[model samples]
Target: MGILEVSNVNKRFGGLQALGNVNLDVAKGTVHAIIGPNGAGKSTLLNVLVGKLVPDTGTVLFNGTSVLGLKPFEINQLGISRVFQTPEIFSDLSVFENMLIPCFAKRDGSFRMHALESIASEKDIIEKAEHMLAEVNMADKRHMTASSLSRGDKRRLEMAMCLVQEPKLLLLDEPTAGMARADTNNTIDLLNQIHDSREITMVIIEHDMHVVFSLAKRITVLAQGTPLVEDTPDNIKGHPKVKEAYLGEAAA
Candidate 1:
C-alpha cells in the first residue's frame, strides 16, 4: 500500500457532483502530480485530502489510518500539511515571526490562546524554525517583513512554514500559479530540493505542464470529476488518450 490512499471517493455540492469515484495511491517519498482542465475537480480532491471538505462517500487513509472527518488542525497533527494556491502568510509579521507561529502551534497544540507569550524565550522553537528556513534557503531573509518579499520569496516562506512541522505528506495546490517563467522554474527547483532532502510524499495540483513534468514521477489526469489516467511522466508524454483528453495535440 502507498502512504496515502484514496479509494472510490465521491464529493457532491448540491446537485453538482464535484468528484466521482476518485481513487489515488501516492507512494512514499515521491512527487505525484494531479493535472486537469478547469472545473475537473482537482482543487476539490485536494480539499477532501486536507479535511477542508469531507467526501460524500469512500475513504481516505494516511499511513493506514482513516482521516475522513478530522479537522484541518487534526489532519495537520496527523502529519499532513498543505499550502494553498495563494500564499498564506502573516503579511505584517517578519518572516521569522511567521515561521514561529506554526512551530508554536505544532508544539503547544493548535489552540494555545497565549498570543502574548514571548516566542523568543522558546529556544527549541526558534532553532526548529531557523532550520526550516534553512531547508527552504530562506534563512538569510528571515528578518525581513513577509509582505516585502517578492512573489517567489513569499511562496518559499509559506513552504518553509509548512515544513517546520515535519509533515509526512505535503499537499501543494497550484504552487507555481501566476508566476513568471523564472519564478516558476525557481519554485520547481525548490520543490526538487525539498524532495531530495526529505522523505515526505508530495501531491501537487498544477495546470502548468512544465512544472508538472519537472518533478512528478507519477501523474494522474482528471476529467469530469474522475481519474482518466495515471502514469509516469514519460508514458504520459506520449499517451494517445492523454493527448486527446487533456494534453492536446500540440503536447503529444
Candidate 2:
C-alpha cells in the first residue's frame, strides 16, 4: 500500500460533480504528480486530501490511518504538511519569526506566538528552524520582513516553514505557480535537493508540465473530475489520454 491512499472518493457542489470515484495511491517516499487542465478537479482533490473538505463518499488514508473529517491542524499533526500555491506567510513578521511559528505550533489548531518572549531558552527549536531555513537557502534573509522578500523567496520561506515540521507526506499545490522561468527552475532544483536529502513523499498538483516531468516519479492525469490514467512521467508525456485531457478529442 502507498503512504497515502484515496479510495473511491467523490465530491459534489450543487449541480456539478467536482470529483467522481477518484482513487489514488501515492507510494511511500516518491514524488507523485496530479495534473490536468483547468476545471479538472485538481484543487478539489487536494482539498479532500488535506481534510478541508470531506468527500461525499470513500476514504482517505494517510500512513494506514483514516484522515477523513479531521481538522487541517490535526492532519498536520499526523505528519502531513501542505505548501499552498500562493505563498502563505506572516507578511509583517521577520523571516526568522515566521520560521519560529511552526516550531512552536500547538496541535490544538493554535500557534504559540507568545512563546517568542522566552525564545532564548528554546535552543533546540531555534536550531531546527535555522537548519531548515538554511536547507532552503533562506538563512541569510532570516531577519528580513516576509513582505519585503521577492515572490520566489516568499515561496522558499513558506516551504521552509512546512519542512520545519518534518512531515512525512508533503502536499505541494502548484509549487511553481507565478514564478519566472529561472525562479521556477530554481524551485525545481530545491525540491529535488529536499527529496534527495529526506525520506519524504510528495504529492504535487501542478499545471506546469515542465515541473511535473522534472520531479514526479509517478503521474496521474485527471479529466472532468475523474482520473484518466496513472503512469510514469516518460509514459505520461505522450499518453493519448493525457493529450485528450489537455488538447481535446481531436488530438487523441
Candidate 3:
C-alpha cells in the first residue's frame, strides 16, 4: 500500500457529482501529479484528502490510519501539510512571524501565537524558522512585512511555513496559478530542491503540464470527475486518451 491511499471515494453536491469512485495511491517519497481539464474534481479530491470535505463513501488513509473525521490541524499533526493555490499568510506580520505560526500549531487544533516577549525568548523556534527561510531563499527578506513581498516571495514564505511543520506528505493545489513564467519556473526548481532534500511525498494538482511533467514520478489524469489515466510521465506524453480528454495532439 502507498503511504497515502484513497479507496472507492465519491462526493457530490446537489445535482453535480464532484467525484465518482475515485481511488488513488501515492507512494512515499515520490511526486504524484493529478492533472485534468477544468471541473475534473481535482480540487474536490484535494479537499477530501485534507478533511475539509468528508467523502460520501470510501476512506482516506495516511500511513495506514484512517484520515476521516480529522480536523485540518489534526491532519497536519499526522504529518500531512498542504500549500494552497494562493499564498496564505499573515499580511500584517513580518515574514519571520508568518513562519512562526505553524510552529505554534498544536496537534489538538489549539494555537498559541507567541507574543513579542516570548518570540525573543523562544530560541529554538526562531532558529528553526530562520533555517526554513534560508532554505526557501527568503532569509534576506525575513524582516519584511509579508504583504510587501512580491508574489513569488509570498509563495516562498507559504512553502517555508509548510516546511517548518516537517510533514511526511505535502499536498499542493495549483501552486503556480498566477505566477509569471520566470516565477513559475523558479517555484518548480524550489519544489525539485525540496523533493531531493527529503523523503517527503508530494501530491500536486496542477493545470500546467510543464510543471506536472517536471516533478511528477507518477501522473494521474482525471476527466469529468473520474480517473482516465495513471502512468509515468513518458508514457502519459503520448497517450491518446490523455490527448482527447485533456491534452491536445501536441501531447500525443
Q: How do the residues 39-81 of candidate 1 rate in per-residue lDDT, one tens digit apiece?
A: 9999999999989899989999999999999998999989999
- Report lDDT (CA) for all predictions: 0.91, 0.91, 0.90
Per-candidate RMSD vs. true structure?
Answer: 2.0, 1.8, 2.3
lDDT per residue for candidate 2 within 1-252, as digits (tens), equals 999999999999999999999999999999999999999999999999898999999999998999998999889988899999999999999999999888878322455446346778878878888988887888899999999999999999988898888889999999999889999999999899889998689999999899999999999999999999999999998988889889988999
The candidate with the higher lDDT, 2 or 3, is 2
Distance (Å) between predicted and true CA of 150, model 1? 1.4
Error of 3 at 103 (Å): 1.9
The predicted structure with the larger TM-score, 1 or 2, is 2
TM-score of 1: 0.93
Predicted model with the maximum TM-score = 2
Q: How accurate is candidate 2 locally (lDDT)?
A: 0.91
- After superposing candidate 2, which stretches have Cα over 4 Å from the reference? 106-117
- How far residue 20's Cα lies from its native spot in candidate 1, in Å, is 0.8
Give the per-residue Cα lDDT of candidate 2 at 88: 93
